[model samples]
Target: MGKYEKKLKEMVFRLGYFTRNWRQIVHLALATEHFGVNNRTYSPDFSLFGKRGPGKFLGIPERIRMMRARAFMGFIPLKDAVRLFPGYAARHGYLKGEENSGD
Candidate 1:
């Protein structure tokens, strides 16, 4: 891989997290006290296509697969999302506990 890709992966490794199974997902769903809501995880692999997709020359399914890879699910607290993304969750109105979030 190129140096930039290596560094990007490292940064993601440092800041990103993924849950291994449904139990954890459920825990995140039922355990959060903020608005009695389920917080979800943010996966980079799932968002690979958010900014741009593989060149249009590629087949549509391939592009879809690139976007729908099996690497983007887990539960991140909305609070963590606010911290990780910095104002994005609030602006997007995902903050069910806005008053509790102190944002």
Candidate 2:
């Protein structure tokens, strides 16, 4: 691979490592508090994701896979997301804000 590609790959790997390690640390802390082994009482805030209903819990591997799939599906880069809408507008002959106009 070229120098730039190699550098980019290294950067991505470092970023992934940092993110994974951070999550693991957070999970460990949560688990410790969850089991009530700590001297202080701790309560988990589940309101962010809503109630934890019955379902298969996703471990780190599954979470990473899902993140990778989402990244591959053009979910990144807000600037590029606008490109996706132009084609549909061309096909329908509709400008963005003038959708209500008869013209």
Candidate 3:
């Protein structure tokens, strides 16, 4: 019904885990391969409330919706988590069979 809800629906479908009916809630985590450091790190922002909500019964769908909304904001200027685009793409499966393809 809202923007976050809509985004959540799109992501769920994109990850190849779509549910046929509306009432059916197939709660699960997506396997995200983030592009960056040598140590592989999955998309940590997909959780219900990593740093947002805790002990909140907002439902799995709602949680995902919020996460999707935050993702739209793009990578923030976090000094600790920042990295070059080429390295990022390479780690995130965006590289087309080449190291640092974005370059």
In candidate 2, residue 101 scores what lDDT? 18
Question: lDDT per model, in order?
Answer: 0.39, 0.40, 0.37
lDDT score, candidate 3: 0.37
State the local distance difference test value for candidate 2.
0.40
Q: Per-residue lDDT tens digits of candidate 3, residues 1-103? A: 9968855654655344223321222222221223211222344334432323432444555655543333334632222111223345466554558655231
How high is the lDDT of residue 29 in model 1? 30
- RMSD (CA, Å), candidate 2 to true, equals 13.0
Q: Which of candidates 2 and 3 is the stronger one according to lDDT?
A: 2
TM-score of each: 0.22, 0.27, 0.22
lDDT of 2 at 36: 28
The C-alpha stretches of model 1 lying farther than 4 A from their native spots are: 1-74, 95-103
Q: How close is candidate 2 to the true structure, as a TM-score?
A: 0.27
Per-residue CA lDDT of model 2 for 9-53, tens digit only, reads 656755665464554334333333232222223445322222233
| Backbone collisions counted per model | 2, 0, 2
Cα lDDT of model 1 by residue, 1-103, tens digit: 9968855764564345434333333323333223212223433233222222434334445543332222222234544444544344555555555532232
Clashing pairs in 3: 35-91, 35-92
Model 2: per-residue Cα lDDT at residue 43: 46
| C-alpha RMSD by candidate, in order | 15.5, 13.0, 15.5
